[model samples]
Target: MNYLETENNTKITHFVLVGVSGQPHLQIILFMLGLVMYLITVIGNTLIIVVIILDSRLHTPMYFFLSNLSLLDICGSTTTAPQSLINCLQDYPIISYNACYAEMGISLCLGVTECFLLSVMAYDRFVAISSPLRYMVIMNKAVCLGLTGISWTIAFLTSVIPMLVTPVNFCGHNVVNHFACEMQAVLKLVCSDTSTSLVLLFVGSIFTLVIPFSFIIISYLRIVVAVLNIRSTEGRLKAFSTCGSHLTVVTIYYGTLIYMYVKPQTRESEDKDKIISIFYGSVTPMLNPLIYTLRNKDVKGALRKIAGKSKA
Candidate 1:
């Protein structure tokens, strides 16, 4: 159905996106609710980015990585949330092929970049825990910049190749099922043979999921071992606490992602796919800043200082 709708120069120029729930009674409430969530997600991630940028004290490798993660959360939320809010409110959520392609491209890039960056952060924690004495030397400014740059570069390159292989052909039904032009949703609309698309998605998953998951596991294993070696209970507690919040967030993000893409692609039940997509996309980004701030004293202290300074 989507393929025929996407055939070359198909009749539809703008695609409709039917959001998760369709009850008229629920739409208004969901719209308002999504708006609030979207706002909170933006504000929370933005504050983290601002705090890291303005405080020279946070200019170290740790905060640099944190800033990148916050930025990713902001970009990630923005890619999905506003459109979702609009879809919940409006009679129709329409998107053009060009716009859909752009959204899918950027979302894929940012999403993949975040997965790698989180893995890099785990390694940072591992080094800090396993070899605290040399943490500063190991994760110097040069190394920090290199890791961040490479993460973004890899993400862009991976997403771009798939898009290049499959140009936007609009010869089908224009309405995208979900709010955003996610890779799967977009691919489902393609008129061309999507084997290349599937292959590219497979390679992307290897980078975004497999490699990163392995790194995260290895880093945490080393960290757990190092923490266990600490004779003092206080020392062990502190060491584990540092990465606990991150581990929670990563588990949530990756768990849903694995469920979505790690298996063979089957036709989705609308409600089921919508709920799952919300987990990885909308809800996760909304939770990131809270998770980091609650777990890290430094961020809490920074927020307190910012609040105090504002009053003065």
Candidate 2:
């Protein structure tokens, strides 16, 4: 590996991020847009975290998971967006090799963690809606903590293992076409054999995407069946209302993610690909907290109360 940095070293030491679109005229526009987005994402997610912390009313399992998810989104978007915002205004955005790897690794960890966390939250909803009698027992403190712990562990392992498989020293091209250090984009820059690494990526995809997707599907199916069995129409309405926000968020989050990853990488146009990446990496995080809070009356009321107290 030292040879990768020696007198004979021809391998690239850093990568240039092509970063979104490049119209000299659009740079200022993009920088302003990204700055607004980054601020909204940070502040919105921060409010969610703070709400969950400051309000004893939000200490429920659902809010507990939501606070964790909010924190992850803040970290996730910040890892990619701030740099992209700066790069949008600059002539070049250069990322050192080690920094690239670290960014890629951490982004993967948080991204995958969020995926599984959403699925886990979906399950929590399933338990609450389908088995109200047993909900507390099922999602007790120990169980919630255990699930959170496992999600983080799986996320770290999924990220680190794929990173380990990718060669740190590649012989040629060092520019990442995308704004951020996604595994797919970085691995495309690898000069060494990536067939094995791609296969492992597929495996990681199964653990990160497939397994969580399966859990979400099964949980929802059962919840639907359970809801239908309720004798009163009001009971069913109430049940669905509880799940409505989560279902909407899951649809948005997973739908964008699927568009980003599941498509044939070979066929996507650069601009189209960047658009999809932006939705997942930059836009969705900004929207998630708002979606959860605005669509739910309880959260809205809580926020109003918090605001009122502050003003008072």
Q: Residue-wise lDDT of candidate 2 within 1-312, one digit each (tens)? A: 122432356656688887654677777877787888889889999998888888888889998999998899999988888878878876668988778877878888898999999999999988888788988888999999999999999898887775765554456667777776666676666556666776777777777877787788888889999999999998898778777767777776777777666554442236566667777777778878878888767687888989999999
The TM-score of candidate 1 is 0.91
Q: In model 2, what lDDT does residue 172 have?
A: 62
Evaluated at residue 205, the lDDT of candidate 1 is 82
Best by lDDT: 2
**Least well predicted 10-residue stretch by lDDT in candidate 1:** 1-10
For 1-312, candidate 1 gives per-residue lDDT tens digits of: 122343343455566776644677778877777787788789988998988877777787778898889889888888777777777877667777566667777787888898999999999999888888999999998999999999998888877666655544545545566766766665566555667667767767876898898889988998999999989998899888878888988898888887777766643435566678877887788888888887887888888888899999
TM-scores for candidates 1 onward, in order: 0.91, 0.91
Clashing pairs for predicted structure model 2, backbone only: none
Q: Could you tell me which 10 consecutive residues in candidate 2 have the lowest summed lDDT?
A: 1-10
